[model samples]
Target: MAEQPQEVDFALAAYREEGVWQVQELAHDVLENLEHVSSALRRFPGDGGAVGMVAYDEDVFLLVRVAGPTVRLLLSDITAADEWDLARDAVEQLGLPYPEEDDDPAPAGDLDILGDLGMHAMDMGVLIDDYDLYPDEMLSDVAGRLGFGPTFDDLVGLTSA
Candidate 1:
């Protein structure tokens, strides 16, 4: 069997600062809890709102958006719902039932992380359902939708070449 990846791979947090996108990353331990992630994101220094994406290797992905005091979340798989703290917190945030071991890793919860930035909920659903794409690609699509594809790609060191 392939070795399982660590629960949290990496997290990217970005927000518009003075008309430019400012991006930063968080450690895995920080993602093991929600309040820590919140505290970290709030320090980005931006009035244009903040958006973040956390990928748990090939298993799952979590998207978080903070606009002022409101925080929104999107988890890629509900089957692995209770497997990690981020997923567990997401379930609690949505008041969702924890998925069992036999459950399929279907995209769960909603993807309104960028609704205020112009990504429609229905469109996010479609992107989330495109199983052919991996977390980075899906997030890249999201970045594109949010008008930060290149900037985000650059921050994450992803190149289309």
Candidate 2:
């Protein structure tokens, strides 16, 4: 597994530009919880709503895209259960009772968020169960699946091999 940081690392707000994807690394302090995630969405001055990715540790990562009342979710570890504020806020955002997953890594919401963009459900399923990868790696997969692999790798400070 890649090294994971203890505190929140960094976030990226991604939006499509003329059919091409673009990613921008956000300030580390810009994200702390689901509310901050929502704030970032509201602050985006793009043509469409932007998706937010927050990686807390190797075991915790959150994918959020808010469109009005609906906040789509894709969490890496369901066991975080309030252990991390990011996870806690996600459950709150979805109004779901925490600690009820029965110890599973299955994602929380629509696995096919990027299905329309490029990723298929089966591919997203594989990524969700890949516990060996770190949060950044998982988010990298998400970005890649959504048609922004190289851009995501560059923005996340990862070099293509």
Candidate 3:
């Protein structure tokens, strides 16, 4: 069984309603599983549904975009499934096979998850492939691209106060 992380670096829900973006901190419990995260996101009244961003132990990140009955996912590193339950769950949800020990670290699932929101699949791939950036940095970039960078940064303590 894959081990779950003891703590989540951060988990946030970002949504837009009435043409304005609302960013809020998600409870750590919601990071227990992808289902919980999705459920939490559904409670938001975003015009295009809500998005969940979670980073665990500074090692991996998960993105869940819920729009009505449709749920799209993105795992920053497919290899994380070997030791993280959330990553394992994400792999299962994406209908992907488990990664072999030798598999190189790479992103798995919908690269186009945020395409309609302005971050194209190609760009997302490039961002995820950048090893220098931590999960928080990557997520910050996503929020910025989606027009809510500063808000997200502030919420996650990425901004210097």
Candidate 4:
């Protein structure tokens, strides 16, 4: 049998320190874990590049690319206990399929890391969607509808309000 390294678990414990559960910290930890797992998995059969992030509802998730698609995994959340239950129920209602097998290696599910950071749900999508909440058409339409002038910036901002 091979002995696994204890160092990663030690770092994970440190990263998830109690009362220090900021969303960014959580996301960074998730990402680190993802990189670790993906790299380890690379020594095996499939590609090794799974990634993790926190999404709109204080949800921590793992995302893995498979067959050219991104799969999600819901790891943890800082939201109400019932929130995850509700999301899972909604997904079942929507007929989304659960992962097929452990070896299949797909992402878990959508998580609400955004809510953990106190941002609106749409803001979570903005963060993951490459920081562009308003696409070109949507931006133009909203600007026209609200009679607002166009504003442009180099990078999309994700600061908590």
Candidate 2's residue-wise lDDT over 1-161, tens digit each? 12222466667888775766767876655565577677777676544567888777556777787655556877766667546777776766667667765666556666776676677678878887887888788778777767788888887687766
Error of 4 at 54 (Å): 10
Q: How do the residues 41-148 of candidate 1 rate in per-residue lDDT, one tens digit apiece?
A: 776777666777888766578887766677777888886666676778877787888887888777666666677777878898888788898788788788787777
Per-prediction tally of clashes? 0, 0, 0, 14
When superposed on Cα atoms, how far off is each prediction in RMSD?
Answer: 3.2, 4.0, 2.1, 16.4
Q: lDDT tens digits, residues 1-161, model 4?
A: 01212111111111112323211112222333344433332332222222222232222222222212333333322121233332343234335553333333222244342233233345434443442332322222222222221321111122222
Q: What ordering of candidates by TM-score runs from best to worst? A: 3, 1, 2, 4
Model 2 error, position 7 (Å): 1.3
Superposition TM-score, candidate 4 onto the true structure: 0.23
- Residue 8 CA error for candidate 3 (Å)? 1.1
lDDT of each: 0.74, 0.71, 0.89, 0.28
Q: How many backbone collisions does model 4 have?
A: 14
Best by TM-score: 3
Please list the residue runs of candidate 3 whose C-alpha ends up more than 4 Å from where it truly belongs after superposition.
1-5
Of 2 and 3, the candidate ahead on TM-score is: 3
How well does model 4 score by local distance difference test? 0.28
Runs in model 1 lying further than 4 Å from the true structure: 1-7
Cα error, candidate 4, residue 56 (Å): 20
